[model samples]
Target: MTNSISITKIRQLMTMISLILLTLSITSIAVRGFNWGLDFTGGVVADIQTKPDVTQVLLKSHLDSALSQDVQVTAAGNEGNWQLRFNDTDLDLREALNRALLPIDSNFQVTNSSVIGPQVGLEMVEQGGLAILACFVLTLLYLSYRFEWRLALGSIAALVYDILIVLGLFAVTHIEFNLTVLAALLAVMGYSLNDSIIISDRIREVFRAKPDGETDSLLDKSIVSTLSRTLVTSGTTLVTVSALWLLGGSALEGFAIALCVGILSGTWSSISIGTLLPRCVGLEPNHYKPEETESLQSMP
Candidate 1:
């Protein structure tokens, strides 16, 4: 029955959340300095298809020694095919690995060889970085148009916090920054926005229901009331993403893990960022509603 919300509480929560995000980002940078994967740093990758009778261990060993350079070999397609990779190709591990294979079976032709350059990868990084910024800008615009500008501003700030926190984790954990991982970040952005929007919608309902309402208290109650729904939705999403991470192989692992980070962050942001933000900024419910217009009397 308490329609009043406390603005002070909302500001406190926002301040704390902001600080937590900054700490997470700084700590992450200090720890690993962002692990740039071979794709970004420049390296060699070869897809060598061989006979079905080939064994992974035998192939790995053969390539490692014949090339005189360290290499990793794994089944490429079926049990018959193999993919070989070496870092910083100046040593020619590819030739060495191929030579090693000749002793076993020379027919293992160099089906594919791609020497990824740092410059090429750097461009990719730039493009990817731009795309992320674009998503945030668009999300901000859309939210502002649909709701109030304050909500829009708060939602974006929270999203940035979520992203920074995830990056910090990547930096701290030293996760490889590959194309797959970049894709994961984009996915998280979309997911986090969706979650925050849901929480915002609920808080709006509480606002219009009470006139002269305090936003902080209303937001808090709205958060509590929607807590069950939030958990249920997030829990289900986590379960699906968990399965992909656990069973989808390396190809999907990064994507799934990114979701795990993002979804968790999204849940937190919904309450801490989305809910508290609009209230903290004094985005009254009446601000969004169109004013009623009276019909003009016809010459009374």
Candidate 2:
């Protein structure tokens, strides 16, 4: 009895915390919005090879002085290979590059230069939004088909919870919202859904195994049973993502950060929202039982 009460209390606390996070996420998105990156907004990108002695800071400083607007410089892949991005569409990139870079490298060369028009950016925004919407719809359909209505809804709620929290992290931090971060969001959805399904399956199994068990006690047992699996999966993924964040360079920084946040939030939502919502909606063992087949009355 004590254990059951404690578990119930923990669930309530976690639910409250999740609600606070969700509310904050929505509010931040509404007020602050996202920090759209060059990929989402029209901009100029140039790949250049700099002298061995030219560092990113040195190049950025020189470009900042030469160009009329701000320029962002990030290392591309190999040594002395750098990419530059700026929103000054009217500024002459070739002239600016020549003026600033020639003084330093003398042999610096511009390998590629391209412009992303506003129309293309807008189209990308529309398509990315549609992709996320489609993913949610498909997930909802699959979950509803695979489980009871209550469980399916709970799983969906958990997924939404994970996404909002991850998005909120980006919003609050003002991190660059680019294509890579968008990809991370989609990956988060898949990871969170997998975790939720595993817990839901365990819940159903526990309910069937002990039909008369108390709801809180049974749910507690189910969560406890899968806790190790969740930890191992999340832990290993985080390790790899952390490596990417540390060594993958500026290009992949946003992607790695998004994944890290998503993984942590996904784990939390799966353990709390995924299981608690179903219980709150009155999920019971009877919901999983086969329909009773009535015996035909004996002919009198």
Question: What's the TM-score of every candidate structure?
Answer: 0.83, 0.93
What are the per-residue Cα lDDT tens digits for candidate 2 across 158-180? 99998899888888999889999
Model-by-model lDDT, in order? 0.74, 0.88
Return the clash pairs for model 2, or none: none
* Model 2 ranges off by over 4 Å: 68-70, 292-300
Residue clash pairs of candidate 1: 5-214, 5-217, 6-217, 67-96
Index of the highest-TM-score prediction:
2
- The ten-residue window of minimal lDDT in model 1 covers 290-299
